[model samples]
Target: MSKREMKIKPVIDRTFTDCMEQLQEGYVCAVAATAGCTVEALRRDLFGGDLLITRDGKTAHDQEVSLLLQLKNTTTVRPDPDKETFSYQLKKREYFDRLAAPRKHPKLLLVVMTTSPNQTEWTKGTHDSLEVQYCCYWRSLEGEQAADGVQKPTVRIPTRNVFDAVALTDILDRLDRGEELT
Candidate 1:
């Protein structure tokens, strides 16, 4: 067969979901670094969570404040009619139960949503700046009950709970003050 007659196929090892997860994790790491926090990745798929975020500087009387994060990337998150919240389905009830359970370190679900369905458009870089066309929202399922016998449960996250640098700082501050996140 001539070169023009042969079709070339590209092999892709990572799925879109995987790429989105890594991108979101990197974004979180950048924000954490800017806020003087440290982010450590847990064993992949072994624990119920992905990253552990801890405040960097610890005072004499201040206890260490850390947050366990379950990171999710989705393109099918549905916005409510009122636009106050968005609903995302948790694929595993076991994972949901783990996040809902009370623990020494508070747990949060961080869902990263892509603004565009196209993976290529998810990020753009220039000499001056890098733009990521994604937004992350956080929800604390602590002390909540998972539906009985439901393998996949849908959870609603408030629109106001954006996972930005300000939100992270606020969350860490609250935890350091011995305050629970709503």
Candidate 2:
């Protein structure tokens, strides 16, 4: 066989290596705030989402997996782009029902992901508590350079293009195990 024919192709692990990296960093930041230390003090690798956390800890108390909610532009079940501005409200309602609690009392993070104009429009609603934690298409999907180049804002989904349910489940499982995501 020719050298070209013998060459093996590398496969992409759509199992969420990229998104996990982003989430790990975000978790570190959140943990740092809780620890009363600069984010840099935390080791980068500590955010690997590998630490096993007990399900019964005070921090894990009343934590619901669905609180880490995600809404994306899916193939058939996507949120209505025309009604994108109201997407956050809808997600909040779903979250409330899923966790059987009010939106303000969530024990876990509330994450929302959307494409450009939708993210922009939703962000304009400054009064919305849900929009405050928004991650835009540009930051998460398009890979834009932020004003602060070192710390680019990230989107919180399993993958760049498609939302992988298996990978999401694994990540959540790790979180439920008390793994330090950051």
Candidate 3:
């Protein structure tokens, strides 16, 4: 492959990587909320049907693909202020890299959702290694919940950017369309 062709592969891989990280974080949230539920159980709770189904359609439960999409929206960028470490928060880039490795298939969709007002630099270091499609951040009326039900946490959520054009999307599209982007 030419230099341009060589460059394009990494870009596509990185975009897919970002998407996968989002999916993994989503998976973590789904797992945490369910309190150690199995992946299938989590799937049932979130998607209502098996993981194979993608589009929003009839399923065993009223769960919509949109609900599965909520994973992208459920991340908390910071830890509860009272909590010592940001344990529950996902490591965005690392998660993306693991999922986007060569042998893996793009089986799931992912995105970031935040409850903070500013997200200008959230995914800063991972662009070269991951495919972060959509990044969405919103304000929280109440922030950081404690272990008890008393405290509400502030956070941000970024949904999958499958809807539009982004650097990552541009790269993936080019690759998919049999073109090269250096």
Candidate 4:
């Protein structure tokens, strides 16, 4: 076929938000797998949560600990000069309320911030490795009150709460020990 006639149309168009969400979800899934846990995607986005994590092979009523995660992605989060924390504004009041409320399952807001603004640089792959250019932080809003009449509520996430395999394992261990995740 002639080069001019070989142009192919894009099959599906995904917005930047969609791509970011997918990337963050993939990262969480990988981390959970490595930590010997299982992640379930909530198709309906119930309770403003995107995913649920359950400890593997621990079904005892006392030992069973399931975590609910609300995943968010952005390229705009800039940490404070001290690098102690960063803030993210949640757009939905419902989400804020749900996350802040006490529930049977602990819920956390997991925000994935991209290091670069360029979407093309978000991921890189080679035979030896695959790298995702983003870092995630987790915050628990339980017992916190949302500002009344505010459509969007901003929450601060600690830099120390990096969402990684170690962090996941620690969170699970804490939950299994009947300790609060806060």
Per-candidate Cα lDDT values, in order, are 0.74, 0.31, 0.32, 0.76
Q: Write the per-residue lDDT of candidate 2 for residues 88-132, one digit (tens) a residue.
A: 222223322332222331123323343222222322434543232
What is candidate 4's lDDT per residue for 1-182, written digit by digit as tens? 65522332222334655777778889999989999888999999757788989876455445556788988776667565478877889878887888888876554655545444566777799999999867788888888987789989998889888899999999988877768777
TM-score of each: 0.83, 0.22, 0.23, 0.84
After TM-score superposition, the amount by which residue 2's alpha carbon in candidate 4 deviates from its true location, in angstroms, is 38
The better-scoring model by lDDT among 3 and 4 is 4
Sorted on lDDT, highest at the top, how do the candidates line up?
4, 1, 3, 2
In model 3, the number of clashes is 20
Q: List the residue pairs that clash in candidate 1.
A: none
> TM-score for model 3?
0.23
RMSD vs true structure, all candidates: 6.1, 17.6, 19.6, 6.7
Candidate 2 overall Cα lDDT vs. reference? 0.31
What tens digits encode model 1's per-residue C-alpha lDDT throughout 7-90?
Answer: 322123346556767788888888888778889998775657888888855677766678878888765554544688878888
Could you tell me the lDDT of residue 54 within candidate 1? 86
Q: What's the candidate order when arranged by decreasing TM-score? A: 4, 1, 3, 2
**Which stretches of model 4 miss by more than 4 angstroms?**
1-14, 58-63, 80-82, 106-109
